[model samples]
Target: MLIKFDVTNEEGDRLKMQYGQKVASKAFKMAALDAFDLYHKNQELHEVIDSQRTEIRRLRNIIEQARSSAAQLLEKTGQGDLIDG
Candidate 1:
């Protein structure tokens, strides 16, 4: 009974192994799971960062508009000259 299996490494190297060989399939599975978990975590973090960036931009626009409106109000109320000095 010859059972052949192929093991691939991160660099895409294929290693041929026979059945009943001392291979760490459990360890490989664990590493794969860890990598998948990290990938998902990074994706979530990126989404959160992107959302915060968008919110920050929106808030900055609102603040700029408010500042412009306040400056206009000051000018209309004759307080612009005081601020200019």
Candidate 2:
């Protein structure tokens, strides 16, 4: 399908208006492309954050295990009082 429209300045010059609209349209397209690129990069960053969260949880579990083992050792050595809990 094809559609067309005519616009004119106060001096009745259509060429000037057409040129201005063309320039404006180009700028709008460029801006839209930049926005899309930024959205894509944001999504990538979110994935990285999710992976880092998983890694932090795993490290926390390891630390808890070490603490439990140390407390058990103190009890066997008759120094359980050294452990707070």
Candidate 3:
């Protein structure tokens, strides 16, 4: 496939530099494919990181809830000040 790009030069022949994408060789195609592969891999990694972040937040919330419940239990049993002292 042809991948044309813009080429602008003042005081130069317009015909010499076409102001659009043009045909690319096998090397260009390979490079483009490699770039695409990297992009997809990066996207996948980002998704995994985001998922891990969500889990971490959830776990943190659970830990906070457990701590709060434990404190309340201790207060009801008149043992809250034992730890504080």
Candidate 4:
């Protein structure tokens, strides 16, 4: 997700006063780079999660098919009541 987060003026002033201009600018640069890296990582994690969900749905479908086939087989073999009981 593309987030719209901002560092306010008060925060900027605090950083400047506490760390001086050079260090403060470097810190801001690092923060921006870190945020960029995190955004890409977050996107990758989401993609993985989506793929896993798709896989789970596929597996569920297979399981349902197997159960249906098993019931059919039992019915053909005169064992339908065996499963119901």
Q: Estimate every model's Cα lDDT from 0 to 1.
A: 0.68, 0.69, 0.70, 0.80
Clashing pairs in 2: none
Local accuracy of candidate 1 as per-residue lDDT tens digits, 1-85: 3333365563222211322224446444445557888899999999999999999999999999999999999999989987778
| Model 2 lDDT per residue over 1-85, tens place | 3323443334223333634544544434445567889899999999999999999999999999999998889989999877655
**Backbone collision count in every prediction?**
0, 0, 4, 0
Candidate 4 has its poorest 10 consecutive residues by lDDT at: 18-27
RMSD of 4: 7.0
lDDT of 4 by residue, 1-85 (tens): 3444377877766766654555556556556767888899999999999999999999999999999999999999999999979
Error of 3 at 8 (Å): 18
lDDT of 3 by residue, 62-84 (tens): 99999999999999999988879
The TM-score obtained by model 3 is 0.60
Clashing pairs in 4: none
User: Which consecutive 10 residues in model 1 have the weakest lDDT in total?
Assistant: 11-20
lDDT of 2: 0.69
| Cα shift from native, residue 74, model 3 (Å) | 0.7
Q: Which stretches in model 4 have alpha-carbon errors above 4 Å?
A: 1-30
